[model samples]
Target: MKETYGFKTVPITLRESYSASKNGWSALLLDDKNCKEPYRSKKYDIEIVDRVGGGDSFASGLIYGLLEKQNTKDVLEFAVAASCLKHSIPGDFNLVSIDEVEKLVKSGGSGRVER
Candidate 1:
């Protein structure tokens, strides 16, 4: 843990895992202050359009979630969801609103435009 090395211990640790078997992405977040069992997010099956700003988007979402004072589960889910949506956008920027990311996080991400 970076906290052990005199670093900021905000989220503690976040690990992103890619599952070739499921063809999707899942994330694990560990923060003792948040939950007893490590918080895990449901897999996000997204189409990769552009990976340029995926990481930055995740960090942006994480900051927003923290600012919103969300729980550990919701924060991690929002960050991961935001990053996944970035991959589906074809540019260097993640042009998604909070509602878009929240919709994906809450609705299990169908990856389709609603009618």
Candidate 2:
């Protein structure tokens, strides 16, 4: 089907969660060799005034990474990083720049803290 559409196809897995105990949602980018983990996860952060559209933000970031032809690991990292940034902002748009996402990718989750 992908070849028919001329799209660089990727598989998407959706897990069903009926557990009210589940406090958050996440998405994982799957490829050969277990290349990445779930891209986003939130354990009920107290600061979030609005929970709507957060998943859309994650989807945006993942799609952005894929458009850049990022490797599975980088793609997952970018998505999660973007989602993290999304948490700090108040809007429908994630509003994170590609360079910022790249910085986080390069830092391997341990970037410097500049105040």
Candidate 3:
């Protein structure tokens, strides 16, 4: 798909809750460099205030990372972390800043965000 589509990287969501008891999500990044990086979000075990916009938040974070030209690892972590925090929010709109997401991504990042 990457070759045919000329995609530099392709991201696929991993909703662990669909298969397991844990309500968390992860992501898979298929890089054009023949690398498959799996990024699991931190901040799992959080009580979800709202279940809306998880995927959108994830995509936003990914976009932010890409726009900022961050590293792949950081990008994935940011995406998952952003989505994780978004779940704690009470609305479909995510209001978190770049700093907050970076903090979450930097500290104890890459695991799974529990809902």
Of the candidates shown, which would achieve the greatest TM-score relative to the real structure?
A: 1
Q: Determine which window of 10 residues in candidate 2 has minimal summed lDDT.
A: 38-47
Expressed as tens digits, the lDDT of each residue in 6-93 for candidate 3 is 8878888766563323465667776544446544434354456687898899999888877774467777777888887887788898
- 54 Cα displacement, candidate 1 (Å): 0.5
Which numbered prediction scores highest in lDDT against the true structure?
Answer: 3
Question: TM-scores of the models, in the given order?
Answer: 0.76, 0.55, 0.75
Clashes of each: 0, 0, 3
- Please report, in order, the local distance difference test score of every candidate based on alpha carbons: 0.68, 0.52, 0.70
Model 2 regions more than 4 Å off:
1-27, 32-50, 111-115
Candidate 1 C-alpha error for residue 50, in Å:
0.6
Name the lDDT of candidate 2: 0.52
lDDT of 3 at 61: 89
Q: How far out, in Å, is residue 52 in model 2?
A: 3.4
Worst 10 residues of 3 by lDDT: 38-47
